[model samples]
Target chain A: MSQNNLTSVVVGNRASISKPRLGLARKRAIIRFLFILPTLIFLAAMFVFPIIYNMIMSLENYTTISIATGNAPFVGLQNYIQLFQMPLMSQATWNTLEFVIGSILFQVIIGMAMALFFKRDFPFSTFLRTLILLPWLLPLIVTGTIFKWIFDQSHGVLNYILMQLHIIHAPIGWLISPNMALISVIITNIWVGIPFDMVLFHSGLQQIPDELYEASSLDGANRWQQFIHVTIPLLRPVLAIVLMLALIYTLKVFDIIQVMTGGGPANTSQILSTWSYTLSFQDMSFGQGAAVGNIMIVISLFFSYFYLRFTKES
Target chain B: MPRQGLRRSHLTIIGALIVCVMLFPVYWTVTSSLETNTQIFATHPYLITPQFDWQTYRIALQTQLPHLVSSLIIATGTTVLCVLVATPAAYAISHLQFKKVTWLIVALLISQMIPSVSLDNALFIIFNKIGLLNNYFGLMLTDCTFSIPFNILILRAFMQSIPKDILEAAYVDGAGDLRTFIQIILPVSKSVLITAGLFAFLFAWGDFLFSVTMITQNSFQPITVSIYGYISQYSQSWNQMMASAVLASIPAAVLLILSQRYITAGMTSGSVKG
Candidate 1:
């Protein structure tokens, strides 16, 4: 009887101790949940919701009319199909590819040159380096506007300078000519993007130890040889990152193009982003616009995947 | 030694020349803003204004001041909202033990890849449904979508560098998580908070895409949209357009000059650490 009583007492103690501990754990979990709840909720409403809604809109015929009527008829794959049929689609796609390629190519080359140049510590080097970032610091609209005037064919400073130097007899249309418009915007983009690339490369260059350079010099390697073998190899990781980021940023470029050309001169300068905007906002073809946006997202995702993989490996 | 000194001086000259070339466009905008309409249209490009004219600036301010004010409010609101939301979440993600933390991080990374244009398309429909269209609150909220993820990532990176012992000491002193965060974490993170806030400010300030898409009303338009509209409307009036562009660029230029270190740190931290 005493043994049974002791056993009952131990069981009662165990249950009583376990109950509050479980409750405390639940309380802690609730508190933890509260901490992240606001961010998760905000992201859900903003990021996740919009993306899902975009996908849904891409599937349906969700035009301004459908929006007004509150009746979006489901038409699976039709919008995507119609996207391919649009004449501007191929041009915009090709232009986007060209823009990304051209912008990245020149930005990296010029930026690398600047980085290598600035690596030598001359007087006012820091001040000059900071000053070089002015183009990047200005808003894209401002850059676009300035470039617009700078390339103004007849009275543009570019023409004035070229004419003064007797480089050309006739004024060259920088933004007006169809063939030159894409190149003009690419030049503007390159200017805006160079500082960003330069800054990253500068940081990367700073990371490479001075000892390595000294060692290369001791082995009778000239500056060019050292740069090719030592600097290039050491800078590869930073280069990969800079190139990927530049690609991603350049891919979604819209402000400059919109301000400069609005992807005009017969849609010759149209990229997927501006074309998407034209389709949805201007033409009110939300479904096709969303389809184009999805296509962009897919492309960005592909790059992002490589970025993630690259970063993981490095 | 003298020859080496001369060579270094030569490098300085070259650097100065490069800087001048880079900054010519910026200088042109300012100078053009101060020039007369006739001078702007002259065949011979005047490096300096023929005559100084403040009329363009006065006109730009007269018409576009309201838009600048709107931009200030929207940018300020976005920064405040982003910091408030991001700080606690960053604290939790970095310090707290949670199973879904990795998923939240992955979500944050993936969110950056989601294009703003795509978000704008869907947000228009949703905001329209709920009467958020043409509203400052709605615009600020949408801007937060971009900054929040970025701010959280930045703040979390900073927060992780804080020693665990300091936070643990607070816990041992009978402080709760909220108090510990406010008293210990926030004070220690002043610099990073400022960095993150500065970036958020710049992001919203320079935003043309969201401002154009979200608010169509002229009165409610941000400076970016206003300047864009001004340029389109006054295509022939180069001076007036340049004046507005100059006006719009001041905030970014000032921030770049003042807090360049923070900006550089914030930018590199995101990519390098990732």
Candidate 2:
């Protein structure tokens, strides 16, 4: 639980160097054990057990009928081998990469801009900040639903606006076209992601001392110069952490893409999540779905290791 | 005077541009929601329509009100469960020096980062086996898996910042650990609790993929799934879908506004990451 993690780190600090008596330390440790044991058990039962069971299930051909008849057969690594053979599975992997990279780059750049804009003492910055939260605070399904409407081929607001502004003479398909569906989903995702990144970066910006800017200015630094020499370096840690977390999150995104496009118009928008769902639930290929899931876990673990190492070094 | 005038003009122009770009989608949603079905499909989307209609809102509300209720129940249930379970665990980790606590927290973090979609097939099997697939408790349990780690991390940061002497004083007064947590820690850490709960509510509410996979019955489906049924590949009920999305987002938006202060602080503290 949250309490144990905090207390453990604090206790691990070892600043109480006077060294308390063994008897007292033992008593405190006992209390700590008693407090945390319940949580560990709960996690083991609900999380660890199911995951381990899932791993086993991945090696076997299990289904509703298999469960009913107790006729499930162990398949070993065939599930993973099937993954590479399936074209859709390979496509899903590629799509996951595209979604993660595209979403993070756009979200971070726009977020950084918004953060800088809001850092100023504007008249309606508070109102703008609240408005920004609208996209993020709304449920992913809701946002996807709204975006689905926006991308509608017929009677879609996007086409309507484009015509009125003379931007495009003909109605452009936003989601229906195989090429445009993924991009439409990406735009909506960027809208949803911008708020979290901006707020974090904005707060990070505030933590940087104004005196640094003043010092830079006195040394003949212009706005761009001050930003390059002062702001970027100062915000690097926050930026790095935010970028890494956002990349990890966007990689696994599911609800929005599914609700909006259903990985449809010929599965152009399918990512790992939807692909996994389709493989296991829809196709009754539980083993393949587990392989996809395992792939996702491995990728995320790789990113987490890199992130932790980077943070430690800094 | 010249420099001031130029600076003012530059800010005004840039600010106006930013506002236009940022508010366009939201503006489009609200405006399109008010338009008639025919007008919504019009090739050129007009910012100001000839007429506004509230019929779509009325229809969506009348037809799918129960689904809205389902969403509220699931969100509230998941948020309450995550906070309750995560709070005690977070408290222990922050204050207790248990063996292998660091590795435990690391495991918690890694568990959170794993995509929920990956678990769908396995979870489906597990739920089907237990006869819990269509139940609210099943949804709540799965949502808790995704929520507890982040909640624990944020709440732990807040609890760790509290002076240890205060806890020792409570101990000196013969206050039990539970008594101290309930009376002292909870009160001081209210903001962090609220922030964590807000995220829990948001995640539970917005999640569509799991809700659709877990609940087969139309009556038990959440608002997200209900709204999803309104759209198709060829043509969608744009007016109704937008109206439903706007309506669904209201509660979450209000929650954010109400806890704006804590939300900001929670973001800052989370990034500090001991």
Index of the highest-DockQ prediction: 1
**C-alpha displacement of B35 in model 1, angstroms?**
0.2
Candidate number of the best TM-score: 1
> What CAPRI-style quality would you assign to candidate 2?
medium
True contacts kept of each: 0.62, 0.54
Q: How high is the lDDT of residue B154 in model 1?
A: 90
Model 1 agreement with the true structure over B1-274: per-residue lDDT tens digits: 1123447788999999999898889998899899988888887778988788998889989998999999999999999999998999999988776667778987887787777888888888889888999999899898887788888989988888887768766765656678888899999999999999987887888888889988988999999999898778878888888898999899888988887887777877766665
Q: Give the CA lDDT, 0 to 100, for residue B70 in model 2.
A: 95
Q: What TM-score do all the candidates reach, one by one?
A: 0.94, 0.91
Worst 10 residues of 2 chain B by lDDT: B1-10
Error of 2 at A173 (Å): 2.1
